[model samples]
Each structure stands twice: as structure tokens, then as C-alpha cells.
Target: MTAHVAESTITVELDGQVRVVRRTTDVPVRNVKANKPREVSDVV
Candidate 1:
């Protein structure tokens, strides 16, 4: 059996077992802004 999940995910079942599959694609980034200095709170 197979089922459609959220947009990029899917579920499949066979022989009493189930598996989940997810599709992902790398998105090209353009003109990214420079990183800003993090505050002390930003550190764990």
C-alpha cells in the first residue's frame, strides 16, 4: 500500500512493514545577505 503525505513526503507499506519517503531538492540561493553578529543569548 502507498499513501500520499504532505507535499514532499510519502508513505509505503509492504509485507506488514511501513516506510516513509521524502523528496527534497536543493534550492539555489542568490544574493544572500551577510550574517549579523549574534547576541550572547544566541549561544547555547
Candidate 2:
């Protein structure tokens, strides 16, 4: 499954003008599950 999350942006003022130093973008997130370990063998 995939999920879209919104990110925040940062603004800064330099010289005498206000500008967006960092921009916001849509980030894709996914759910993950770890695999189960295999059972140990009695005979080695």
C-alpha cells in the first residue's frame, strides 16, 4: 500500500525580499513487514 503525505515549506527574508528557501513536496510512504525466520534443523 502506498500513502501520500504533504510536507511543510520554509520561507526566509534576504536583502529585502521574502522567498521560499525550501519547497514542499508530496512524499510517498509505504508499509513494510519483515519476513519470519526459518525454523532451525535438529540435524546439523
Candidate 3:
């Protein structure tokens, strides 16, 4: 449970002067499971 995005900056003026940019990114979510605990053996 995590979510955050509060950092931005963008200015453009091509063929003349200023051009500043800042785009952010952070993604890390990995729960690689190979049957951690999934037991189902009830055939009745």
C-alpha cells in the first residue's frame, strides 16, 4: 500500500530560450510466487 507523486517542473520555449523539464518515476512491486502456501487436496 503506497502511492506518491508530488514533484513537477516543465517549461518550454523552442528555437528561442528556456527549456526546463522534470518527470519522475519510481516503480517497485514484486511478489514472485511459486505456490507459497496454496494447498488444495480435498477430493470428496
TM-score of model 3 vs. true structure: 0.19
Least accurate 10 contiguous residues by lDDT in model 1: 25-34
The candidate that achieves the highest TM-score relative to the unseen native structure = 1
lDDT of 1 by residue, 1-44 (tens): 54545566657678878888875744443434647998676556
lDDT of 2 by residue, 1-44 (tens): 22223355445555767665444555533434546899998996
Assess the local accuracy of residue 42 in candidate 2 as a C-alpha lDDT between 0 and 100: 100
What residue pairs are clashing in model 2?
Answer: none
Candidate 3 residues lying further than 4 Å off, grouped into runs, are 1-13, 26-44
In model 1, the Cα lDDT at residue 18 comes to: 87
- Cα lDDT of model 3 by residue, 1-44, tens digit: 22222356445565666666664544442443334787989999
Please list the residue runs of candidate 1 whose C-alpha ends up more than 4 Å from where it truly belongs after superposition.
3-5, 25-44
User: What lDDT does the true structure give each of the candidates?
Assistant: 0.62, 0.50, 0.50
- Report the number of the highest-lDDT candidate: 1
Cα displacement (angstroms), candidate 2, residue 1, comes to 42
